[model samples]
Target: MGRTFHRYKPQKIFEKELQTSEFYDCKEKKWVAVIPKMKYRFVIALKSDYPREVFDAPKYYMMKVVWKNGKEQVFEADTKDALGDAILRFRTNECFWNNLGRYAYRVYLDWVNKSGRLLQ
Candidate 1:
């Protein structure tokens, strides 16, 4: 139905939530919401080491996200600077789980193919 990229699909449905206490400045002993709202992310399932030609590429790293209000999003992973750095900028607290998530990492040489099902 949709753009089939390497057999990646919605196998599992879950959202990895990131929550933390409101930040409180030392000088100002008061707590404040980070954004005055809650944050949510999604998790989807896809194939591992999925062949290139599937999406007219060599491989794929697909992901699904469920937003707050129940919305689904699917997209590919972009590799420009560094994957580790990307994780650091986003999931700093849960970066440890990056290497153990549904995100797929591939290259022309050695590659990593895994889904949320197998990894998580």
Candidate 2:
């Protein structure tokens, strides 16, 4: 019998709407995706130690929300879909309001009203 060879294709992680451009961070030496918002931005990076091809989806993602005033929070998810859901929750005010306070939430609302998709 002859040996068989098969080509491998990486699976897509996030849906179309949840997808974002990724860039390599020289300081961190990892691939990361940055999602910008009205008052803060989410930085999601691969937690794996081994290097991966740019198109490959990692198993673990680490999310960091960096606020305008330099405050930041960290979160983790096993899949990219879950990470996207977390970001959506923060954007739609489903959670995390208390930490940001009422004032920040109002500001975010105003921005969403005035600029619409500019928040994304």
Candidate 3:
């Protein structure tokens, strides 16, 4: 058997916009993307150990929304584009949070039903 490797071309469209204000979080030891809006602050953390490089499509990433009330909601995605799309959707619609939360809940239910394991 031979190992085959596939190379994916990095998508720079969102990366260009997101790269403007990325900073390393010493506490988490990961690069985090920050986009501040009037209602809340959107943050995306990439699961990478190397500090020098930021992958355009990180295999694991987390999206977090921090509102003025100090309550936060966190969502995890396997690719950066998924989180980016969520952010773009929210930016366009103020009511997107309700939909986002519903969608996340549905996904969680599906996962639990299929895997028969609770998410930690």
Query: Quick one: ranking by lDDT, best first?
Result: 2, 3, 1
| Model 2 C-alpha lDDT per residue in residues 45-118, reported as the tens digit of each score | 55654345434534566555566457777656676446545444665442344334233334333533553445
Q: State the C-alpha lDDT per candidate.
A: 0.38, 0.46, 0.45
Off by over 4 Å in 1: 1-15, 20-39, 47-59, 78-120
Candidate 3 residue-wise lDDT at 91: 45
**Which tens-of-lDDT digit does each residue in 1-120 have in candidate 3?**
975545543221211011133434555656566565224444445553333334554345665555445677776666544654544455444344442443343443443355454545
**Index of the highest-TM-score prediction:** 2
TM-score of 2: 0.33
Pick by lDDT: 1 or 2, better one: 2
Model 1 lDDT tens row, 1-117? 777545434334223544433454434645556665534454533334554445534433345544435665454544422332443344443432232222322221112222222
Candidate 3's clash total is: 0
Q: What residue runs in model 2 are displaced by over 4 Å at the alpha carbon?
A: 1-39, 49-58, 87-120
Q: CA lDDT of 23 in candidate 3?
A: 39
Can you rank all candidates by TM-score, best first?
2, 3, 1
Judged by lDDT, which candidate is best? 2
Backbone clashes in each candidate structure, one number apiece?
5, 0, 0
